[model samples]
Target: MTDDIRVLVIDDDFRVAGLHRDAVASVPGFTPLEAVHTLDAARQALRAHQPDLLLVDAYLPDGDGIRFVADTERDAFVLSAATDAVTVRRAINAGALAYLAKPFDAVALVDRLRRYARMRNLLGGDAALTQERIDRALSIMAGGAEPATVSRSATEQLILDGLGDDDEASAAEVAERVGISRATAQRHLAALATRGQVEVRLRYGTTGRPEHRYVRVGKR
Candidate 1:
């Protein structure tokens, strides 16, 4: 990749397109070249700007986003809420580098984009396509490991890291530090508990039934 990697955001929802555009702009070595809400507009933008990367939605007003990826020269990734396995497989078949679910945090977007930038840089200008290169790209897209070895999401990782120092933290406290909801914090905590990473204790309150508090298993 060059010093500045240009990205085009294509989504039917203008708000979502803007969000993705802003996310790409916030990443280092990246520039948001255009935000288009339809496949037709995306094609026009692609012809005009020739971006280094394309972030396209699975659903578009004009046509299937996968078609755009199939026809475009730029590296593409799908950002959508659609979880159907068939759709995801089609996207992979269409040459999307990554398939990110919707409502992902900006940090996750940056991570994916940075990975793509690294892959592009490694290939260099005029680099020949090889089996090794294809394997590396697939590995990156598959989260760099087999399913069993893959780590948790960024939000989950943050929660785990935060729990590293403190043996215990309330859901409210975790939410405040992680910038998520208390319910979301609790759900993650429960998942960690299930995995034996932490232990939970119920603290009874005078005015209510009880509240759950979590503590790292080995820490305390």
Candidate 2:
């Protein structure tokens, strides 16, 4: 790649930052700029290196990574151990591109990094994106670029965004959220399940037949 994406890995833990640096380096179109431990160091490095992206942790000794990232205006994704909804919401509100809870396999992080690269390329083009281009690019971001046979339509993208790989939601719930028919939501969810993009399980209740709930598979 002519223009490799420069990345800085920022975390309070030295070992974790180094591991993330390696993961960022492993991707084809990404370059590891440097890994820093604290928010102060991250700021100095950011000013010095001006990396295109940041692999950030939410907790920093000097300051909050969410505020730092939001202030920086650079592309960022969080690799954090904080699993609370509040933290997740703050990260999202801070404009994090994506968030992964910690203690996860490095492979999962690499997958998201690669997906983000694809996303950057698609949306970062100088020319304005057409409607179809926007839809397809977002679809690829959600479902990934693999399994070329399985296509993700705009409706399916809505389902995936609502279903979010971290939690389980019933078809009706997803339908209501995305404003789609329950049957349509269920069909898309089933398609995603067949692709190993989601997990389907039976949710047993007090006095009814088991209801099928779909959960995203890669949140560990």
Candidate 3:
């Protein structure tokens, strides 16, 4: 049998689901199955495809995505815009291997997938396990890393300054406030999040996908 890891992408947003499907397909030794939207579709896909890993979001039309992951008892990780402490804790409690916030760059996702693959191989190997091997595998699963510290450029600083103390704004709002394009604002915000200079939070509306908003660290 093939050793490729099968991944199922579940998101309410069609475009975001497609983006994740492409991301999963880009990784070596990983196969992307059909991208599904609602929780009902996800359930059908799970029963039909039995994917090895799930790339799921928190908000869905039918129900909570993380709870679905818990109920299925599958090997999965959350790729979502839900950054609230309660949501994060619930995912962890429900046995999600990782909870990646939205707006992450493609490189970050690739690296996480690679590390997960490595961890999977180590755990699935037939060889006898040792302390060192087990420790290494667990470390990969933990995925702990110190936040990066980097110098900001002029444009980045302008974007940062646009936000008032204790205020949160989406990339578009930041862009308008800073007189830059939304794409430029998003890029700088992602960089700032990586550098631990800002925090990205998700705000769900009455309908549609959640909005990713950024705030200065220690402000929230």
Clashes of each: 1, 0, 0
lDDT of 1 by residue, 136-219 (tens): 445655556422332346447656655665657898867644444578778888898999987898888888778888887877
| Maximum-lDDT candidate | 3
lDDT of 3 by residue, 9-65 (tens): 889899888888888889877999999998899889988988999988988988999
Instruction: Give the 10-residue window scoring lowest on summed lDDT in candidate 2.
Output: 143-152
Q: Candidate 1: global Cα-lDDT?
A: 0.75
Candidates ranked by lDDT: 3, 2, 1
Worst 10 residues of 3 by lDDT: 143-152
Comparison by lDDT, 1 against 2, better one: 2
TM per candidate comes to 0.60, 0.64, 0.63
- For model 3, the stretches where C-alpha displacement exceeds 4 angstroms are 125-128, 144-220
Clashing pairs in 1: 1-121
Query: Residue pairs in steric clash, candidate 3?
Result: none
lDDT of each: 0.75, 0.78, 0.79
Best by TM-score: 2
